[model samples]
Target: MKKKILYWGILSAAVLVVIAASYATWNRLDPNYTCARCHEISTACAKWEQSVHADVTCTDCHGTALESFNSMSEKLNMVYKHFTTKKTFEDIHLTEKQSLALANRCAECHQAEQASWMSGAHSTTYKDIFMDVEHNKMERPYWDCFRCHGMFYDGDIDDLMAMEGGPEDWHIKDASQMDKPAITCLACHQVHHEQPRGMNYKDMDETSRGALAQKAKYPSTALYMRADKRHMPADKLLKEQIFAGDSLVAEIKDANTLLCMQCHAPGTNHQLGSEDDKTTIGDFKDMSCITCHDPHSNQLKTSHRNVHKKLFSTLSK
Candidate 1:
């Protein structure tokens, strides 16, 4: 009986050792090479290798290992499916939940930008935007509403609210989504794209540094238009027509303001200051939307002191 007990104890210890070793191996294989093992994602892996975030691990931005219990199970399931099924992998896209998870990862590197985004109107929650009694009562909710309000949401506007038109009974379909942000950091920025290489601004001449800062391209700056379910590059957004009365006053062709115009401009009518638009006129006619409004924080930088101070402080830093 003593010999039998000793043998079982040794067997259990060996099982535990095997389990530990397997877990370690699983973790070790989470790097980019393991992801590239699947040919479908090899292109993405290659792009990531060339990106500014090349140093960042594949799992850091993509997986929710610590947050979700099903993350490991999901990966295992994918592997199983890949082996057993004949279906070829077309593309891998981030779900709303996965995209939301990236907010924390982004905050890890860009705390100041994250803080500014969180504090702004752009960070408004689904409940704040959709379930507002005053706003809903005034105007009817439609499918186009999600174009700006809940851009990251995978489902249609009908899936969110009950009624369409005036004085209708309304309630959120998913109570859990009430507090979740409709527009997240990924709504405006593309993580996979490369950025301008960091220059020694301090060592460079003031003119050279200023020129570099002005000309440096923000390749990652994009507007995630829910209507098409694709990211429109900030520089390539469609030019919007601004109207004063009957005549077209200006075509907002500025690349910098293009992303902002996606939501801030007038609706289909394309009239300035219509449908929650704050398009400026008079002395501010030539200025871009970003002239007064801080893009991330949405704070008014109208005053010369405030504008120049922020500019000089950024340059000095």
Candidate 2:
């Protein structure tokens, strides 16, 4: 009786392992054909087939099955919904945490930029910003914080924390997001910026793609406006005037500068040097934000005041 039970158990275990392996293999081999049955997926797949990333596999960027634990949760959730409801994922947009998990994936192509951004202030993780004793004590956590930090975060500040009063009372609700940076590539860049490509688009080498990118006229740089629930293009963004007391300091025209001011905007009183505003005054009037604050790594120029003062002196000549 014991021998019979042991043999059956071993056989069952082997069968389960074989089944799991088969399922994983089938998922990775050719999911596009199955996915293409859906209209939106089909349209996206068709465009991707012609894009520069045609050679890239669907699962490479968007993780599915057992590829990544971070992505598996969401993927499995969506799959469960599809199986149970016979429904499609209507909202394809990923939340802030999910998107950040894919940030390193972007490094496969943009290594240099990724390294720079990782070293910058923008790389600050959720724990560093939200659970801060100093910051939270001063202002208290609020929805407004998401405007700049966790722009793509699906929930409000309260959803992330259980705050009673001080830092000691604060406990982050979702510990998984503690290590994830609130901002990511999607915070600034819009993928799929182009469609209907030139001939042999898939055959174009990296150098060719790099050359095209330099001259690319596409409006890809964007900012997430919580109200819009989407990243608004730089051109479409309204250019606001920065004021200093009674005088107007600067009116944003350049797309890059426009995006910067969207977050580093003037205070409620419409005054520069307030809130997060770093609007340069006096001799630096004509200069753009990117002139010093490199987007990849927003490292301030040496002794910011001295650097700009010298720059101003040079400009005068």
Candidate 3:
């Protein structure tokens, strides 16, 4: 009887694994098709389709498979179950904290972007700003991947479904505006199977271009972003436009200014070249914000000072 019971338990566990895997697979497939239909304004999605990541599917970076979804409790309950069930951290089945893993995975397709991200802050030792405690309190903390990847949709479903494309569209002058939740892996990197036909767009020009050219030896995939901090109540400005509310990791910006603000904000302690000395105004203006922060993990810490240093420097600058 005990052997029979053990066999039945093994069968049950196998079934659950299949169910979970199937659920995740389906969830990952559905969003790309749904998002592509609505985001017609920019050719970005069209470009994404050509990228190597086109085959990866969304769930590869984002988490997956709840019987019920888009509920706050989905994430909360999973987190609770992991803690109470006596599973070791390694035994914990999670799709989060896999940025490095995702980078490694993306390397299978997008070698260039993988190379770029690895050389940058995302793969570095400092805790991800999104996961860290120090930097997340600023005005627009929850904008990008910092909130959505591990955690399911905790905000209004209506708002999420309404949006048409990822935050990447926010910077383009002609990009469309729709209420789209974060959807695809290609949303960030232009993954290409064959080498892209032409020269990729870059910011380097004659005068300041020299340093950027030198830095390009390291080759970074991050984009340039800046918040037009010349606006009103700094906190309120961030809340309405970027953050969902109090949670900094929940930073959401459908606007590029918020993206830019991730680095450009007053009192931002970024240095032009030196680690010890922070950048001055002339130096700050010359450098673009995208040089450091990952758009997805905007709230996640990549640099040493955390968001506080970025925020403080924004004010001071």
Candidate 4:
């Protein structure tokens, strides 16, 4: 019995030592050292500092592996593993896993953007558009947070362009992570303590700027459908307008359509409007989405609430 107890005690001691060593090494291992040194890329350190993203440390986003960090040899092995991994149908080949990891990291700083984005009309439609239920048959999954937002390192282009081809399903194929560069966090946030322009809707005035703002927010939906020159359901709406020559709505609407409708064109249902009222805006056909909702600070506050059009209803008629 004493012999068995002695043997059990020896095993327990060995396990404790391993645990202590692992914890100590983990606490001491530094991610900047592992990633920057083994990769021999000073930009990882340099850009990281200069970027507004400098506020976040490497490990904060990348998720640390202390065992690998404790040994320079192990760290180098991990780098090799990442480069050597095979491609998959998921996102860009070496990216999907790391992308997922970085998304959790990004949430640390972008919780507010995430909340608003979740509530926005864009997010709601993206789920259906990307899923392709009728065609994919395979029921391909949609991109989660990282597919669009995460940063692609400089050399990852080759991995992205290699995916399968089809216009509707092509972005699904591999893309050079390098080509799909991440718009920096500061692209959306005021990270350097700069005061933001605030809600665009709240800033409108009766001056030219506000008039231009009107043109920007509510662009001509009918003229855009007609100008597509492609056959569409909304083309007839443009014909119903009161002008035989160039209608003022058509002229103004076309200009604003060129700017806002570049991506938000007529064919796709933006899901903001109904079948009858969706494209109808009377004289304000020459506007864009940014007119009503400030791209930067449009929250559901009374300050951002729009009342300009309601006040001008008589003139609109």
Candidate 5:
């Protein structure tokens, strides 16, 4: 009995020691700090530090399963790869799966925005875009479709589709991924974008109020450009010209509306109403797209059935 007790005690002590070692190691290699250790990611860390999400930890967004055995194992694997491999950090980017996972995390804070986006056409799924019978019947799905639709998809159009450029008798290679979102929160917004400083709000005049309102309205509203695979500020992007029937009708001046144009505009063909294009013409030539359509909800006030009735009623008076 005495010998058995001694063995049990020894085993218990060993287990405790192992647990303590692991806890200590995990704390020392905290995901937030561990990410900063890489020289290549230092710039990203610096930008994050200046953004609104400076308080948020790297693990909060990047972690797969927090405080779980799998999470710890993943961290360990990353650490091991960092030390053993020379190309561990080369072209490091969040995968489509990772981006989708991170969208849920973003919803925790921006519930209203998430709900609005999810309710709108922008939150369309892979199946909705790729497997639409009517759309496929009219136009065959191609690699160029992914430039706007499935920008974050890991594989090329060839990898996803078994047959291309044909009579629409096709299916996605990964049927399991059909329901997954083709575009997510990260598709349009840059979470780590920092707001500009040095605004003179001292005067409190009408001009000052206007400037402040404009600044507050568009605090770090950035559009993710698929071509560059990077977030570009809306103001810088809106400077580009938009056409309507061979004429440069809309030189997008409003930064807020520019974000919408990124996806809504014409494709490489540059033709109006081509490939999901919604270029404005006629009387709506100079108007911003967001003038009648709510950006998040996509509700068109002018096009509503009752809009004409309301206008006629007002005019009759």
Candidate 6:
């Protein structure tokens, strides 16, 4: 009995020591250091070290998952990969839960902007797009819809919906995601963007600058490319000639228009005014989409929202 007790005690001590060491290491390990094992993360960390958000703690924006001891898939994934794979990895994608959690944190710093975004059409939830009765009946839901509506959604439409229920059934697999917005702050803006900060247009009086408050966003505008699982900066989007049959509709030369067109793509042949492309025509041809549409909300500017527009319309009346 004494011998057996001694052996059990020895085993227990070893286990305790291992647990203590692991907990300590986890607390002490810098996220940047652990992520350095992957080349892509290392490269991004190098940029972040010098970027404007350098002072901000990674966990603050990225969410507690980075430092969590919880049984989240990410923690398990990192550990499993460490043992099995070679040091380098090409892709390090965030799971939907982790991504959503990270996006929720942006509101902490950008309260007003976040509020405006929540009120915008771009902030549509999964239920708003996927489970719609009229639209689903008109067109069967498919993977392609994720390109615009749920760009940040980690899976295809089939994954989110119960296909077993047939074309008529639109049963969502996870009801919890019903309230979560498809397009998040991370959808349009890359936090680690290295560009100089946008002007503080909010502080400027409406008359001081020929613009309304919060009209200008920092140059962080980017589109999340589903194919690459990376954000392609707006300016880098290829300039293509839009056509209405043989008629040249428009040649996209600027980044702003190009950004919108990437997702609000033209028809298969790049035809204008087709496949959700609401290209303003006639008198509105010269006006930019942002001229009438509020950039964040993607809703039309209120009648009184723009002073110049209101004045011009009043004069015309």
On TM-score, the leading prediction is 1
Error of 3 at 82 (Å): 32
Q: Model 1 compared with the native: what TM-score?
A: 0.76
Query: lDDT by residue for model 6 over 1-317, one digit each (tens)?
Result: 99999999999999999987885565456756665555646867765665546656665675444355663566676778767866543466656676677777877766666777878888889888888877887888888887777776777787888756545577678999788888887677666655432333334453533343222333446777766777776667787676767888677655556677777777878766567565544445534556666667777657625543443354335
Q: TM-scores, in order shown?
A: 0.76, 0.70, 0.28, 0.38, 0.73, 0.72
Task: Give the worst 10-residue stretch by lDDT in candidate 3.
Answer: 224-233
TM-score of 3: 0.28
Residue pairs in collision within model 2: none
User: What is the alpha-carbon lDDT for the whole of candidate 3?
Assistant: 0.37
Q: Candidate 4 regions off by >4 Å?
A: 1-32, 66-77, 82-94, 125-127, 131-317
Could you tell me which 10 consecutive residues in candidate 6 have the lowest summed lDDT? Answer: 208-217
Q: Give stretches of model 3 more than 4 Å off.
A: 1-45, 48-103, 109-116, 124-197, 200-260, 267-280, 289-317
Candidate 5 structure quality by residue, lDDT tens digits, 148-261: 788878888778876645546677888888888888877766766764334322324645543443452454467666566677777777454655456665565667666666
lDDT of 2 at 128: 87
Clash counts for all predictions:
0, 0, 41, 18, 0, 0
For model 5, name the residue pairs that clash: none
lDDT of each: 0.68, 0.68, 0.37, 0.39, 0.67, 0.66
* lDDT of candidate 4 over 1-317, digit per residue (tens): 99999999999999999987885565455646544553444444554554434545555655455535444454466568657865322222223334334444555665654555556543332224333446345543333222333322323323332325553544423323333324322222222121123323223343633354344233212221112211121212222222212342233233332333333333333322312122325444534445555432334345435443442344345
Cα RMSD for candidates in order: 7.0, 5.5, 17.2, 13.9, 6.6, 6.1
* lDDT measured at residue 309 in model 4 versus the true structure, 0 to 100: 40
Candidate 2, residues 67-116, lDDT tens digits: the string is 66756677678767656654433345666656766676777777777888
List candidate 2 stretches off by more than 4 Å: 1-37, 41-57, 64-90, 174-176, 195-220, 281-283, 301-317
